[model samples]
Target: MFDNFKKNSERYRDYEVIAKFIRLAIPARWRPIGYLEHLVRSRTGGRIPKGPFAGMRYIHTAFGSAYVPKLLGIYERELNPFIEQACALNCPLIVDVGAAEGYYAIGMALRNPDARVIAFEMEQKGRAALKEMAELNNVTSRVEIRARCKRPDLAQILATSDRALILCDAEGDEETLLDPETIPMLAHTHLLVEVHEFVSAGIAERVMKRFAATHKIRRIWQEDRHRSDLPFATLGTTLLPRFYLDWSVSEWRPERMSWLWMEPRTVNAPAA
Candidate 1:
């Protein structure tokens, strides 16, 4: 009873109230406006102008414009190091859990031609966008799109490859799915998992403890540098809603999201 009361109390906190209000204010049909902006930016052509994955093509979804900095490859400072290490190892396969719209999956495929990417997303819109992006990037041949993935499925997939990398953003599901004892193959695979402590408290510590024996776990928090420089202020006078206008001004990130990057102790580091 007390736990329930505490949870309910947390829900009405100041930040929570603001967040709820923002969600209510945002129009259900945000796609049209986002697509119109995409047209203006000509971002659908999907060329990343700079960064390690430059020259890669990714079809921006209607809502993709909200994360313009991430699409342009400057959102997360911690992401690049793992990407670089993964590329250097040249793992044969990459398993992307919760691969929303094929951003990291397609981008990683573009970065390493020899590696195959298996992207898993359950939502219809996300699947459609991922397919289009993969096709646009000419990576359809190398990228496989899956509607959903389970831990056993992941174990099976990883068992087939000698060396593989797992990039997981499975909301709060990582707690259950990433347990090394249950999924023994995880001990051998390189992993970058988004720890959702915000959704399920103590999950980060639990996940860390699970992999401590065989893997070197590094926790990286979200990067705060959003693309504030975008001309949203000038465009605000136009038709865009106040929700988007306010959201655009800040770097898009959760209050607390940390990534657990795990490298197998047995796996030799690639030569510099």
Candidate 2:
């Protein structure tokens, strides 16, 4: 009887091991599903390319391991930390300048349903895509798309009390976008500007100085020093590759973990 009991116990243990193995071997399908749902919502009507690996293409990155559409919609670790920082703030207005295909703008709108986003894209194709995306995400009511030749005049469009968030990815127009006079209009807004290093030395410092009196500035990410020239064979332009900088701003003290700048500052007083 004892021998029989031992055999039964061994059989039970073997079954448990097999069950655990099966569970471990079966890949979690939910992660991909969640990713797909997010993409569909963010892109709105954009079709997922159809092919043998069409599903996989939705998750691949254009320049890195981080997925392209995902990064565009949600803040990712690979981007400047300030981008995520601004998203966490209690701002009401989000200005996505150079908003290609409205990825970041749509992402911000989806995340902050109550906030209004003005997404500006210079390219016609990008504007069309952004419009479609906003509709797809059901955020058309909140996100406005403007296809313009130059940045909108904030002073003319925004009021002082409106809390604002700015995300600038203009290829090399960081200087023109952060004019000193424009700083006052953004007194209550958080600014996340991408700066290209090769274009001008001390451009970030110069821009920050304009707002230093009223806003706190932080440097969130400085991409590895790389040659800026890349063949623009596709765009029909011969623009060279350029290194870039990502910076953030706050009207008040920023969260410790969210702060990414090498230098931190305190607000001396509220903006007039």
Candidate 3:
């Protein structure tokens, strides 16, 4: 709840930021993005039409903008390559923090049948939705649902696996949970974390520095949704306007967002 607020004063708030606040304050199904969601559901029948998670069904992803974009298969499209790479690894274990409604958790579980996904969603609604999503996709056996992932809980989870893929978006808790000095097991784990700089400042730089010694780090910035990124061919048909198309695909971010992909420098987990 607290992590969602950007803390910028009204006197100098960016218009996009203001829009984001307004969007959050209202019911998600209200307008603009909601309108687009209605159109897409009518077209795609509530399943994700394309992208890596094609054929995946959903109840809701909790957040707005996520609905239509996920259906279109371009939600956080910048991470496509990394997501594919994770699939190739067929990572034995995947830890998803802030697993809001199981987007990546369920999707990855679906893609990598051998993998077990431990999803940690603190919110009751999110946890319930994630559980439902797992059932909906019939991956309930593979996707383990959990609550908050504290440092000790994370350590225990990481220790349970030889190699795991950590997909996280802890809002501002990255600083606390991703600490290598505390959780040395991270040295052997691959991580893709959304650095919520909108609320947690300088966290991106700090995370990079922390992992520079033990991991190969690559930073990815969020990209605007484009018509080309959409799968019109996959969807088969749509006669939407240019504005609607743009709005439907947009992530509707207040400011730019980024993700850090960290691959371990060595295969072996370092000694504690």
Candidate 4:
């Protein structure tokens, strides 16, 4: 019974009803989350403080996840090393699907100046913020912002480059977008896909099956944040109470989340 209630509560939050309520009920930058954001911004000067994308300027808000962890550079700390390594490769094409406010898109752009970054965001506000960040970072020439990423659009983009790095967090749409058979170029690309099991049941299993033949798949689980994960945790805990610090780093995910990092194993990956 407790599990059921917890699951329902998670669902309510994921559907944005709870998150929306929290934002509306509480006015901006005063207490709780808003105050937490203020604290982080003052410390980092509105830039990511200590991660792969350190010194990278961010917008006033993050579209998803709490902005505090993002400023601390530990939002998805699990993927930090992998993302850094991928950026170091400086692949000619870097595609960010379901890019919200250009976190990965703009960060990767700053990391790999030579690469062309294409960001696919459906929401108008997100798209606008992405553009603003790109300009702020002065990578507008290398960054291409686009609306909803359909399979054909992805296929066409991937076809242009022999090697590409694709970071897809399209909610549950990743199942349909990352198929190697339909999008042949995907077989040649390195894909970091967030498999949304909560949003799409059995989607994680299905995503692996689609790419197993062409790539080496590594499953990465997103674990809960610890106090140690935050660079400021050691310094700030003494100043602020524990509860306030906890609210700053919490991502508040709805369910068990995992990502499939699929890298092509062969010079010519079969599009079968």
Clashes of each: 0, 7, 0, 0
On TM-score, the candidate that comes out on top is 4
Question: Each model's RMSD to truth, in Å?
Answer: 6.3, 19.1, 6.1, 4.5
Local accuracy of candidate 2 as per-residue lDDT tens digits, 153-218 = 655545544566777766568677656474456555567776655466666677677768756666
Q: Would you estimate the TM-scores of all the predictions?
A: 0.77, 0.54, 0.82, 0.86
Give all candidates' CA lDDT scores.
0.71, 0.50, 0.79, 0.80
Model 4: ten consecutive residues of lowest lDDT: 1-10
Highest lDDT scorer: 4
User: Regarding TM-score, does 1 or 3 come out ahead?
Assistant: 3
Task: For candidate 3, give the lDDT.
Answer: 0.79
Model 1: per-residue Cα lDDT over 213-258, one tens digit each: 9999898866443224344334432565444433443334445457
Off by over 4 Å in 2: 1-81, 149-152, 222-272
Ranking by lDDT: 4, 3, 1, 2
What TM-score does model 3 achieve against the real structure? 0.82
Clashing pairs in 2: 44-136, 219-261, 228-241, 228-242, 229-240, 229-241, 230-241
lDDT of 4 by residue, 104-149 (tens): 9999998998899999999998999899999999999999999999
